[model samples]
Target: MTARWKDLCLDADDPAALGAFWAAVIGLEVDPDASPSTPGPVSLVGPTDGHRVWVNPTTTPRRVKHRLHLDVDAGSVAEVEALGARVVLPAEESGFGWTVMADPEGGEFCVFVRDEPPAYRLHGVVVDCRDPFAQAAWWGRVLGVEPVHHADEGYATLEGAGPDDRLTLDFVPVPEAKVTPNRVHWDLVGDRDELVLLGATHRWDTPGWTVLADPEGNEFCVFAA
Candidate 1:
């Protein structure tokens, strides 16, 4: 059997505090089973449908713009600001149809202003890399995303299994190289050794999961299945 995408992991110093922030943002509760003093990832599931969110404890701090980020449809600008999200890119500033914003912890996420109702609040996941094609293909294989879609040199994307069940993945090119642990990352269920064979470099490890760096040094994790 192969592994599957499990949750979107955010590395933060305070797992419970960060977890609580997202819990309120998404209307999900912290998993009751999560130990407050575990000193690791605390999983949050809820208000239903889509991948779970995990706030992972880390000593690394965010130093620059995030290479990977979530896109949400958090209410109006007032509501978003009230919830501690601030604008990074106003809709009028970018050609894209989404507004770039950052969470309380400064994790970059976009708020897509759409007429249709928001899809479980979370919409898309964006990754920045030096080569969109290679990164997209690598993650596609690791996550079982078949026939990955290759856009132009600037962009690439692939949809997940169920139509509306999970957020889509988008890979876009950036000039700078990733030199530190990514603040945002994917959490999956798979074998660490197998993943290493699949081109992931083992970085650090924690109980039930192994932190790995992708071909480009982007960090992610594999949980035992």
Candidate 2:
């Protein structure tokens, strides 16, 4: 893989509180590097594969809808709600059996039912773009995964179920401009210079990571690792 799925970066006003909520939901503990008043980002390191959940502090309130969001599977939607999530769209039983929900900070996500147990609870990170195929292809190169374009439903996805992949990233079409910083973003781990050559725009830099926006203006971090 050219790049690894390092972590999920969540921007919130109260990093520790939000991080704690996600920690419980994802069935992980808050890492020693985080605290309620730590004045920086808090993290919940995943059990396997060294995945990370970074809860970052931000004063910006969410203004518009998110172009990308998370999709997780659990026994019940209420289980997630009990941990500080709320229903944004009620349960849908038809095509995709899931419920649209929001976190306490108003970041949108979806919850689906999983009949079988999961290895890593975080299912997939979804993106909304104008051209799903193009977007997926670009990300596929960045993540070093195969891009399987779907022209029927107008979306493209890579499940990471492939023998050479390890993380799933999906893209669907949307007809609107992205107007705000995403509350939820991914941390891309790989060569910074190579990522820039792969159609990523270096937006800014944090202490240990560089913020890069995808072709669709979706911001994700490229960790120095």
Candidate 3:
């Protein structure tokens, strides 16, 4: 009924370097042509049904707070803490229990222990960037989803049909790039037509995905089958 974690967001002085670093870490194939439209570069990692990383461009130095962050399940909290991430504040038990964490970059995202998955799996993944339209254009070529809704360029969503019904992709904008490597990303699957209409633009003759920038210049993936 709604969207879930779509893609990873990474803030870096050099988007290309960070993207390359992740490509190696995740065993994701590097498609050079998939760079973002902004002066900065972008890259796609992994298969459609696995996970994807987005490298956001930023010149601002790491600061006091993060606009958004992720709470990942790496088996245990201690497991991720050992990787150099810190707790901004101690994890708390809420009406609904959840864990709060600050990534290596000091951003905040929450993790929840759930008993059930969404009724319908993610139809498609999305990445918020500087120019949602431009990013949509890039991904439209990657996935075959058509633009179904637009919000004053603030957001753009793509739609595709599956065994059940059509899927959607929504790209939103934020003020700045994330200061840490993204622990949560998307795994795009399905056919290229399903991908292209979603707003992925073709850069090369790759089998899947096209690199693109968001309305605010953030990077995201457009996985094609």
Candidate 4:
């Protein structure tokens, strides 16, 4: 019993504003049903389904680097900065061909500038872990996807789950352990009991879904399919 990828969720102090910033950066439209004046969750949608991003209300401010972040394709760095994003590290410093940027609320996401941007801007969901291989393997089992290990680069990837072909779930190596709940997380539709059997720790339950943390303590929600 594998979980299917549902939506990416972000905890934000100002859901409307943060949602707007992400929509502008990723070329997604703010959900028409969302009320701008309300202090609730705001959702951003692409032209198709399965790539929705939800900006959820949270009183806690970010205190450290995000454990889970997004990597997006953009036309240029300047264009994204114009949307109120700050460049934490330029491409020159990254060694990789991407620029590290932070949203209005200080959530870090990488931007890869291309001469011509792809039809889909959201590139991948990246998780920083102490063991990329093990984390990737565990998530691969939960999602029922094959994990591609890049030992040289110290990363692993799970491709071809969501609607967009360009989107991937990437696990990269990091030195520090997770100290707090991740501000960003993904949701899935699957069997909650099966998830627990597969080593997920039941975190808590809400009215709609049950929250479970992976072996590394990264939280994700599972809903009945």
Candidate 5:
């Protein structure tokens, strides 16, 4: 199975607006397979090869820390700024040089100078819900990863299933209700049509892709061959 940083989930109130903003910032194609009636509901937009960010319609308002987040290392601060990222704090010279900034959606990420070959890397993903245990369990069942450690009584993490891939799923607790659509989502690689029997919902009138969500409403897709 060939895998890299394929997707990131972004909770948003207005899926369309947020998706458009990210498309401009990251130069990604929007609604690559979405339709008019259902509105895709799940937007998979980002760099085609390296990374793809999904915008999910979120009902709960963001008031506390993000359960999931990302840390990106760019070649230069100028390049990211030109892409519409605002510098929350100016770049400071440290023993190791790195600059931090926030995306258009108010998500914080970093830009560091490194010589490693940059293909596709998923820094990390945070999963938040009212019921942490259940949500974690559901994801584990779908992805084949289990809880490796607990961050607190309200949070836990699922470690990567491989030696080469550095992936961690952070599950956090939330008190608010989900109100809007999900702008970002994931794409599973197993049997596409079978997932439909697993509560996966088809979006719009598309045939190549099918949108599915967790019990908590976190969305993902199954790409057909």
Candidate 6:
């Protein structure tokens, strides 16, 4: 059986602060039921179960550019900056429709301005890889979704994967190889053995979940069904 998208997880130095930043920017709320007595992830909830986001605590500092990042739709770039996001590449200078930005902790994300904010601000998840088509295809197989390839743009997208079909998984070509562990990753519910046969290599495991790297070396966690 193929894996199903579970939720998004982010490594942060301060889970509480980062969780608050994302909750405010994305119109989500900090999960009130999240355990406060233990050093655990800070959970953020949206209108749907598929819209959950976890800000997990980590001690390792980010050393390289993020291979995976989030894309958001906002009223304006200034709106996001007001929430502690810093602009890295302005849309006008990049000749792109979106502006590149960094979170308060320096993780990169893209912002697309809209006249009116949509019901959901989290637009998509993007991965930088050497071969966009292959990377997208591999994830499509694992996640049981079809990838729509954009040959002219050198990118591929997997739609219908998250809340209200508003979230997309995008793969775009990049020159650089992944050298450090990704600060952002997604989780899935599936069988570990089946995934291993699908070309995923086991990375490590904990009592709760096992970490596996995809064909392109992006790390993701798998929880048994």
lDDT of 6 by residue, 160-184 (tens): 8666587899999999999988999
Candidate structures ordered by TM-score, highest first: 4, 6, 2, 1, 5, 3
Q: How many Å off is the CA of 63 in candidate 1?
A: 1.2
lDDT of 1 by residue, 1-225 (tens): 346776677888788777877776655678878636667778888654345787878887789898888777755656777777788889888888788888888888887765654536666778898988888788778767753655644677777632245568888889998877788877777899988998889999887678888899988778787
Worst 10 residues of 4 by lDDT: 29-38
Q: Write the per-residue lDDT of candidate 3 for residues 107-192, one digit (tens) a residue.
A: 45444433442332223334546666765665555445566547765788766522224245556576666554233334344443
lDDT of 5 by residue, 38-78 (tens): 43454544444335566767666665444345545455677
Alpha-carbon shift of residue 174 in model 3 (angstroms): 14
Q: lDDT of each prediction vs. the true structure?
A: 0.76, 0.77, 0.48, 0.90, 0.57, 0.90
User: What TM-score fits each model?
Assistant: 0.86, 0.88, 0.38, 0.96, 0.55, 0.96
Candidate 3 TM-score over all chains jointly:
0.38
Tell me how far the alpha carbon of residue 155 in candidate 6 is from the true structure, in angstroms, after superposition: 0.8
Candidate 2 lDDT tens digits, 1-225: 568776677888888888888777666678884654667888887765356777889888888887888777777888888888998877764446778888888888888767763655667778889889998888787767788778888988987732124446789998998888888887767877888887888898878888888888888878767
The sequence of per-residue lDDT tens digits that candidate 4 reaches over residues 1-225 is: 289888889999999999999888877889978636779999899866687888899988789999999999999999999999999999898788899999998899999999999766888999999998999999999888889989899999999866576899999999999998899999999999999999999999999999999999999999999
How big is the positional error of residue 117 in model 2, measured in Å on the Cα after superposition? 4.1
User: Candidate 6: minimum summed lDDT over ten consecutive residues — where?
Assistant: 32-41
Return the clash pairs for model 6, or none: none
Q: Which stretches of candidate 2 lie over 4 Å from their true place?
A: 93-95, 116-119, 161-167
Instruction: lDDT for model 3, please.
Output: 0.48
Clashes of each: 0, 0, 37, 0, 19, 0
Give candidate 6's total backbone clashes: 0
Candidate 5 yields a Cα-based lDDT of 0.57
- Candidate 3 off by > 4 Å: 1-8, 14-44, 92-96, 112-225
